[model samples]
Target: TAFAGVDPGVNESGSYAPKSVPTSKRGSSNLRKTLFQAMDVLIKTMPQDDPVYQFMDRKRTQGKPYYVYMTAGANKFLRIYYGRVKEYLSVLPDPS
Candidate 1:
């Protein structure tokens, strides 16, 4: 999604239906690049039992290209990060 910027795009017809995955131009390219590099490092250093690496390995075994695997991993990382951060924030004491 927004993390990797690969959210699906609406068709040219402008209906609600999405037709293809398109990179959104709104986010910081540097952050995307950092996520990609992090993904590469994770694949190299993480244990095989790690869920993220397992997902990447499954995609690799399925004949997906390197970029595809990395991008998917980055997206997964972002989704996890979002969920964890949201939970952490919700537990904070109210300032009011």
Candidate 2:
């Protein structure tokens, strides 16, 4: 999430937190752009069983802005991707 820069930004001071937070945007812009494009496809295709699409749709219905939901969806996508990859790697035999 942070690696892709889709993680939400943290803006806090002493004991105050803003009502709204934005993406950190500290990672590869190309990656972020690609993820956003993927999200657009998901929105258009409307895959009801896809968890990422469901999450984005839920956020959209809740009145969140386009970018907010898209970024959240991208973050969710990366998390799912990471988990699957980790699971696959764990089952591979050691090269040694």
Candidate 3:
């Protein structure tokens, strides 16, 4: 849901494809809102050594807008969630 909601759309038609990150309105509004809020808290409270914090800090230094950085963080959060869940499921015994 976060992936659907937060990821940018690709434009593949033009000779020069300018990269853009448009805020998508295609997924669960509630989930998107919650993720955005969670990211805000994490950004404020997470230590500098944390990778998400480092990513956000880099974006800040690069002059990305606050909301853009927050959305990127949410996208990162979803990818991490998927990876951990996949790993956990892989370790579980199969049902007969």
Candidate with top lDDT is: 2
Taking the tens digit of each residue's C-alpha lDDT, what string does model 3 give over 33-92? 898888888877978767777887788889999988888888877888889999999999
TM-scores for the candidates? 0.77, 0.94, 0.82
State the weakest 10-residue window (summed lDDT) of model 2.
1-10
lDDT of 2 by residue, 1-96 (tens): 887788989999998978988889999989989999999999999999999999999999999999899999998999899999999999999999
Report the alpha-carbon TM-score of model 2 versus the true structure: 0.94
Clashing pairs in 2: none
Q: Please identify which of the two predictions, 1 or 2, would achieve the higher lDDT against the true structure.
A: 2
Model 2 alpha-carbon drift over 4 Å, by segment: none
Clashing pairs in 3: none
Two-way TM-score contest, 1 vs 2, winner: 2
lDDT of each: 0.76, 0.93, 0.79
- Over the stretch 1-96, how does candidate 1's per-residue lDDT look in tens digits? 664564444446545555445556356678888888888888889787667788888889999888778878877778888899999999999999
Candidate 1, residue 44: lDDT = 82
Clash counts per candidate, in order, are 0, 0, 0
